[model samples]
Target: MQAKAYLQHPILGQRLRECTQIILNVDGRSAEEIFGYPDNLKFRSCLTLFMTATTDNKVFKDALLKYFDGKPDTVTFDILAHH
Candidate 1:
């Protein structure tokens, strides 16, 4: 079959278009409504399908030590005072 014939076939492109429209109409609006923020952020967040974190062995050890040390002190008097 021709490429255009396959694309135009009833079971393919038409159904895909319908599903895409439904998603764009419903989920797109809901996503915008839920996460839309008017205030300007200092930086724009860029998304990547593949991301990597790099650290030296010593740096990772130091960060791990700091994280464990800082955990217990995260809840301070100021936070308790709010309650």
Candidate 2:
């Protein structure tokens, strides 16, 4: 959840767990945080989470596009800030 302000410590602390950022890596922390780890998640929860984190929808949209596009080498799931 790349956003402006700090709302969730669990995800924030994940930053500390990672030694470096890997482009589109979707590491453990990222996977768990974004996709709810091994647990099933609702689309609404994911949507709300993203919306809460992202203040600018346009930027978020762009980032997501590029992420899925797999073109940029700089976009990392570790800290893909969209604010």
Candidate 3:
């Protein structure tokens, strides 16, 4: 499969970075320490799945809209879904 391009919007990029950072910060270990060698790629793939699901799911969208005061357009959910 072809790789998806990195998001062009700064907001989306920041969100993805924050998510990845949160995963890395779990258990007080750096991502490298936690994931080690081959598992790192698998971890990242799972992260992508997470991001995609969060964007595509209606429940998540509803929560996001509520959190951001109904500004659904501000989220790049459609863009994330395609990725």
Q: Please give the lDDT score for candidate 1.
A: 0.30
**Per-residue accuracy of model 1 over 4-76 as CA lDDT, tens digit each:** 4534577964553454344334432332253355311100110000001122123322322332331222233
51: Cα error in model 1, Å? 29
Tell me the deviation in Å of residue 26 in model 2: 4.7
Candidate 3 per-residue lDDT, tens place, 1-83, comes to 12223433467755755665555346545444666875654554444434454443443233333333334432344555665
Residue 15, candidate 2: Cα error in Å is: 2.9
Q: What is each predicted model's overall lDDT from 0 to 1?
A: 0.30, 0.36, 0.45
- Top candidate on TM-score is 3
The alpha-carbon lDDT assigned to residue 45 of candidate 1 equals 15
* TM-scores for the candidates: 0.26, 0.22, 0.33
**Poorly placed runs, candidate 1 (over 4 Å):** 1-3, 27-83
Question: Candidate 2's residue-wise lDDT over 1-83, tens digit each?
Answer: 34344334567534522311232354334323654634212322332344345553333334334333422223232334442
By lDDT, who's the top model here?
3
